[model samples]
Target: MAVTKRRTRRSKEEARALILEAAETLLRKGGPAAVTMRAVAGNLGITDAAVSHHFGTRQELLEALLHQGGRRLKDELNAALKEWRETKPSIQSLVDVIADVYADGAYSELALQLHLSGWRDRGSGLLNSVVDELHAMRTKAFAAGGRKRPSIQETRFAVGMMHQTLALDPLFGEDFRRSAGISSADKPSIKQRKEMWGAMLRAILEG
Candidate 1:
């Protein structure tokens, strides 16, 4: 006789998490096109309507994933900054800390997909809200590090540029830069790019 696995009941939160995890996995493996309710439901051994009950639509599910992913990234950045502050605090340290976060391979990969999808389906507001929140977090982090307040416009601009560069790098960074003969020797690795962006941000915000 073959043993059959028992189906255990899950709480609402657990169910939502499972669905999102399935969807995220699909996204990572096959991009947005692969993330459909039916696919996610099948992955979870549930019906499409069951998954729909949690998110109503695929866009809603994607929005939830973006928010969740953004929060995780922000938390990681905050933790890195906090750990650095414990030793010594400075504007340079701030730059180094966040640059490392940008260079973080796993986070960067997932984030690139989520961001591309966000751009693909514009006007979601989820991505924009997260961006605004990240800006606030950076401002607070700067204050905590004893740097003069950064200007709102400059900070936003710096972050926007940084995100665009960081997000697109996986797809177009090497090829585009190589073709253009952009100096490969000092091509501002992720950390260096963040450092430079940070310095520019500091000058604009602290001046």
Candidate 2:
């Protein structure tokens, strides 16, 4: 007779994380439509009721995933800022960090789906720390060079534009580029576009 293998039990947090990971995998594999409760449960070898118990509904799961992405973006950006403080300021580095998070297109697609479903960010100010740090960095730089410092409004506008562009690029960048006369074969790669944005932002900040 063969012995049965026992399934390891997980804590609530662990199970929730695994469920989110499964949902994210589905999202990456088939975009937002793929990330359903059934699919997520199947991916994790869990029952629909189990997933519901953790997240209540698919909408809540998607919201949690988005928040997780935001937290990752914040952490990576904070790390980049720390490095910049140790060395010279590199706007391109910062741009690349944001681009990396949105490069896969999964997060962008998820965000669009949630917005279409009437989900809003609720002004959680997830990026408020980032905005504050960036403004402080710019202020220090300008003071060091004896130049006029950028107002907080200007900094906020610049950050908003940069973020919006990256967030939407995965969804619309190619189409927009083609519409602007760039051929599919001739259009810049995502990395190149990010670099261009970095240069443009640097000019705007340093001008």
Best by TM-score: 2
Candidate 1: misplaced stretches above 4 Å? 1-6, 89-152, 182-207
lDDT of 2 at 175: 89
Query: Candidate 1: lDDT of 86?
Result: 76
lDDT of 1 by residue, 1-207 (tens): 999989898999999999999987887677667889999999998999999999999878877876676666567656655665476544555455445544534345555666666644343332343345445766787889998765666656665665566555655676787887877785767666667666775665555
Query: Model 2 clash pairs?
Result: none
- Per-candidate TM-scores read 0.61, 0.91
Write down the worst ten-residue block by lDDT for model 1: 121-130
Q: How far off is residue 199 in model 1, in Å? A: 7.5
